[model samples]
Target: MKKLSALICIIAILPFSLKAQRTQKPPLHGKHWMAITGKPLAATAGAGIFQKGGNAVDAACAMLAATCTMWDVLSWGGETQALIYNPHTKKVIAINALGVAPSGATPEFFKNKGYNFPPEYGPLAAVTPGTPGGLCLMLARYGSLSLEEVLAPAMEMAAGYPIEAQTANSIERNKKRISQWPYSKKVFLVHQGEKREAPEAGEIFVQKDLLATLQKLVDTEQAALKAGKSREEAIMAACDRFYKGDIAAEIARGCQEQGGLITKEDLANWKPVIEEPLHINYRGIEVYKLQPWTQGPSMLQSLNILEQFDLKSMGYNSPEYIHTVYQAMNLAFADRDFYYGDPAFSPTIPVKGLLSKGYAKERAALIQPGKNLANAAPGNPYPYEDRQQPFQKLLDIREQWVENPGKDKPGSFVPKHDATYHSENKNEMGWATTKDLAVDSLYMDRLWRGTTSIEAADEEGWVVSVTPSGGWVPACIAGNTGVGMSQRMQSFVLDSILDPYNVVAPGKRPRVTLTPSMALKDGLPYLSFAVQGGDTQDQNLLQFFLNMVEFNMTVQQAAEAANFNSNQLWLSLGGTQVKDRQPRPGSLLLNRSTPDATRSSLEKMGYSLQFGDRTSGPINAIYLDRKHGSIWGGSSNNGEDYGIGW
Candidate 1:
């Protein structure tokens, strides 16, 4: 009897022991490693480059190669904006590899047609893509690995690699779109043998054509270098093959034949935008991001507002801390909607002024305890377009008095506007789209489109953050390039809080919700963070940053921690905002993993909660242990194969 009881007890504890073993930190591996955007093959490919004595750029090249092999939806011929920070130089380089709008684009065209721009500005929105150009340029300037050495890993993977679940999902989601493009469909859907068939799990996938293209570049490099030319010159010579030489001619012909906007002049004129990276100081740590046209500054703005409160004392994910963070984020988003635009066009866009310390202090002072700020107004830095200017004009006209000053404001008269504009909008759409005017009017308005991507190069000790868009929908791919077309109009969505006015503007890069950032403390790399959730990127980044900085959580812990996110542009249930509540620290809504204690506290803070999923965005990151002198990178399993090369 005694033995039986002892055995049972041991069995019960055995499960506990097993659980502990499962949760233990992964055993250490040999150092000097690399991780890329999530995918096993990509990881292997990048590791191969690292092992081959290639630096991060080589690894990045390898990583991109793997992405081409494993995931076409988010990789390949796609634009890449990178911020490569050379730890050695202690300086960051921003690479704008995004495609540019056709010279044909102009904003007046849309208004003239009396048509809202299409979801994705299609043929009209095509831009000269710069992924290949930008990648080659970076290699020319700062890369230690030769083009062949860097591209070899990718070429191998493209020549053959295994397909994963994520790839399948992407194919299915965009099946119709993929099928529409001859090259995309040819490679993605129907190729056979060792050359093109989609691999089942554990099988190798390959891209013979892609490999051939890479090989040609390598051949160019060798020919140039053997002639006693500088390696940079050799690489540039190879790059010309893609931009100004045979490749450009072929691409130009493809676009012209397919009714796309690209011309040989566009390709030849294509030049990568190289600019100084934007940097900001947050809580004694200097953070960095790419400039406007992206929501990178939103993170800085949120951090600035967060610095006002004792967030750490409030605890990680607490309702109080989250509410404060949410409010700050909302304000920052308001500014993003109102002022963020392409600097070349919108000179009045106060990107610097908005990020100024004075602005942050003023915004942070608005937070009130115990209740929400009813009718909370977005920051009005650019009120010229909204109220002040219009109001002053009306006053100048000696307009008749109303019930109240507020009564005449748009928000106050929403009920009246809704009653009038809702029906009027439908009637106007009917008249505008009449057959007589449809094509001509639509053509009159220059449609704008956009694209966004992140790039990392270890050789340069940096990453580039960029969101370039404005011109069109990226649906039509010039067959020769095997790259998809961009219809930037899709960026204009009903989802943005500013939807009605969300039309794409001429020469405007469009207000992107992308917030790519690198966090550091005491001059050491702490995190490389980015998420993809449209406008939610900035909102989500705010919470994650707070979890790490204010809450002092480990990178993994901070990233994995449960939390809520608000689309400052969207609405919530219960006639209230979906908030990160108070009482319970570190509690948020988007994450169902949040503790019950945190939930209860948020409830007390007057928030109605909603559960969300980990698929919010593919959040990818790297954590550096300053004291230990090590770099640990991981991609969230929450969405797709995001942490592929980690």
Candidate 2:
């Protein structure tokens, strides 16, 4: 009778327990740990690590490695950047695993080749890969697992994992390109030259060469350990093998043999750095992002500018919200076009000046409610400059390098931003798909390019947000290594002088599209978030953050919110810039969830609105309600996202 009564009591509480599991929306609540990755398999891998007593950092590494194996957009030879928030220290640190240009790299090199822009693929576009060293560094510093231990899951995954439809589609589309190289094809298409068909969704995808490459790093670490090295020392030696030793030599040789510029010295000299993040105080929330080299600070600048608006009162995705946000986006893009560049090549990046509150206020005054203004020019933030020289000639690099953005091209079938429309009703305005919008838009679809983003959090309040890009595309594998290389070098401009801030030169890093962000409120680490869309990354992230914080939306609701794709900046998606004259990029883009009435209102206001086919943003996030002591996590409903909590 006692056992029966206890069992009856447990059954009675089942509904309430399930109710506790799911609340407001897709962001499942939990008390302990949470991880949401770009793909389900990667999330499983991360969860496995977390279950084994690994902290957020270890799980993040495992997730990233698994993503690299499955997501063709990443490889062992790519780059990754992460923003880590340590709750104990309350400091968000930016980890730059981004590669720098080779020692022999020069802007004059591309210019002398008689090319208006650098090549988008192949060895010449390659940079010294920073991911290998960066991952090991993260493991050595924060993770409890050894480099070999954290990487084992990835090695197992690379050996053989089932491919998905998205990856399969990408592979089939690039079949011809990937077939050119024996090893590149081996990694993607199972039988190097024989089986040309794309692998089905359930087909096992094996990357033997990549597995070997990763194992070699472990082997190096093991050898170091056998030689009486400490765990940290062994990891450092493993990193050294990739950057300064045999691996560097092979990579350099490949670059040389393929008519590229990367030399061994470039790899040896390159070291990823940990730096202070650029932060802005937006409505009592301290938001942090990467440095200017990435499109990171654009978010900071946008938030600072948008801080003046009563966003909650304006309502989410309303005409006023759209108009205000778009104006702020344009202002931020104008500044990004002017000031963002490789921090190493350009030491005076005016980072502080650009992010200043007074500067944001001054720029905010430029937005007028009723009238849609023409392109906003970069503002004068010199008053906020604490550098040696406040006033400097704003070199017109855009005229030469960024000249072909085609901002004047038609952007939508409904009507242009020039607004000659007479109709005010919804039916008068014709509906258009993303493709239909593309017909009149200035932006052309850069065929099949996406990045990878991952986030992890533990009960201890330690959280991490990482964005990994530079997969280098379909067919280009480095020298003899089965692993591919990144065309990150394409981020450079062929200008060695005049533009001190972003001039492309040897040993100078390119301003990459990879930006990871974190947030803190009430002096406590709160959220870790990231996304895959290149230039649209920051814009998407901004919406996600605002949704959770301002509108009190659930994590999934926030991630799936209608995104604003502000293509106004040089977002540098997958190292490929749209090269044509048409309806230009930067026309305001909204996901399908935006009401047709809202779209019509924006159109009437002379805002050229573009439609995204799906209510999707390849964004993922992990939110910490510090006050509640609960964790909420969700991913973008793009099918690729996976959020797990326990």
Candidate 3:
């Protein structure tokens, strides 16, 4: 007990906090409601909304508005995807404001130029910025506040706000890369007609350009209202000002000057879609996720496969437990790399078939009790479909991806990437030759970086969870607005020859990693949550929920649980595996909480275990005690996560 206590104490002092580290900490509880976010001010923003007679949605919007400017990890200049549960409808709905490819983007565009590495940053990486429109849509449709009201906090932030020590460090870490692009440098790197040094931890960081841009949107909406437009119409007017007016012109001019693909027409045509959410019943609790367009379904499929096991008997984080979970996740991820994508783009995507219980049972049976599969290949749920279509596309684009097929080399896998955004700016990082980029593991983890997530629940029984990232880094700040560019288009395959699910298609939304989740207990709303790891979002969520339902941990304890991420699937934004992609053996990463004995047993079971990334995801979550009308709110103690409640 003494030795274990010492280990726990050491973990608590680490710069990056993990779930097991919270074993000595207490859960944050409240009577009225709770709000949690990656940024403390963002959390306060939501709580402030709650105090101002707003519901959960309103609080979420307010938090989002303030959060975009507070952290460099997530931004409104990028895109936002959310899963909202409306008590009025008694249903969970998804808002898909994910950025879409420029209308001018096509397979020939890059192939004609002899391009191999697709640039994920700079003006060329710009897709129509979606977060602004998505926020407006959320407020106009579901929230009580106008866009102006919610954006007020954000505007103040942009004008001038004291930067946090963490934020200053983030800027310092990326300073060199930001300096490569003149416009991006203008806002983030330069100040007072000279190259600005990194600010002190508590120094004021201002984005006057961003303030002007945000103020213009508010002004536009007010003008529309004064012109006799209804509240909804005025909100839409604000959205249009970004996508179709001067802001659009600025983006178009920048992209055109840089020989990029986006145009005014692309911006004008962009609008976030509404999609049907997917859910699975796990031990009487139905967990919900955004459709497979994200990596969300990976968690649902894993849960379905895991349902057949006696998890409690296996023991948490034990050799049996870890191995079983890994196998289940491997099977689910294999399916994800083969079948998940934008349903709007690939009508052929077998979303229902992939999620079917029968399919999960069939896959689960393949897990060997005492060993890891050397080659965990993908399975075909619908053999009748043209499964060869994606392969044929690969053949067409084979020349661009001409890799030295190392059939003779033992353990040779296709090239893999570790970052989310690869830039043409030369200085910007996050691109690759093959496989999906695992952002946090690649570079951001050391700098205490990841995506941003938030959760809020109110006295009125309204609940929401939102994950927002894919901005600031791998970003092309548009014009002089201080609005960072989006690399979400990188989620699209480089060629139309690839599967339609992620093919480079004009106006098609790319399969993204952003997923916000909610859970229904015996048909009643119970929990809402989200996390910040790129590919690990789904995998981490799985670990968190299991800690609670299987181990009987508190909401905060679950939020702090250690997790393992399997990096075997060559999934692109959660879509089909790249054809000719070499298979890598299933590798698992365990947090420090695992015992040496357990590690040895898992290694003996033919699993390679690495120790790093304490929490599977830096999570932010809220759980409601329906019986007492009370709430428990918490953010991951690991990484820079924060939470607040009343």
Candidate 2 minimal-lDDT segment of 10 residues: 4-13
TM-score versus the correct structure, for each prediction: 0.74, 0.87, 0.86
Clashes (candidate 3):
6
lDDT of candidate 2 over 308-422, digit per residue (tens): 8899999988888878887887788777766778776677788888999999999999989845655566776766985543324433443443444444332222111111122
* Higher-scoring candidate on TM-score, 1 or 3: 3
Q: How many angstroms is residue 220 displaced in model 3 relative to the true structure, after the best TM-score fit?
A: 1.8
Q: 1 or 2, which is superior by TM-score?
A: 2
TM-score of 3: 0.86
User: Residue pairs in steric clash, candidate 3?
Assistant: 17-638, 19-560, 337-577, 421-430, 422-430, 422-431
Collision count of model 2? 7
lDDT of each: 0.52, 0.70, 0.70
How much is 478 displaced in model 3, in angstroms?
A: 0.6
Could you tally the backbone clashes for each prediction? 67, 7, 6
Model 1: weakest 10-residue lDDT segment is 411-420
Compose the digit string of candidate 3's lDDT tens values, residues 419-441. 33232322121122212322344
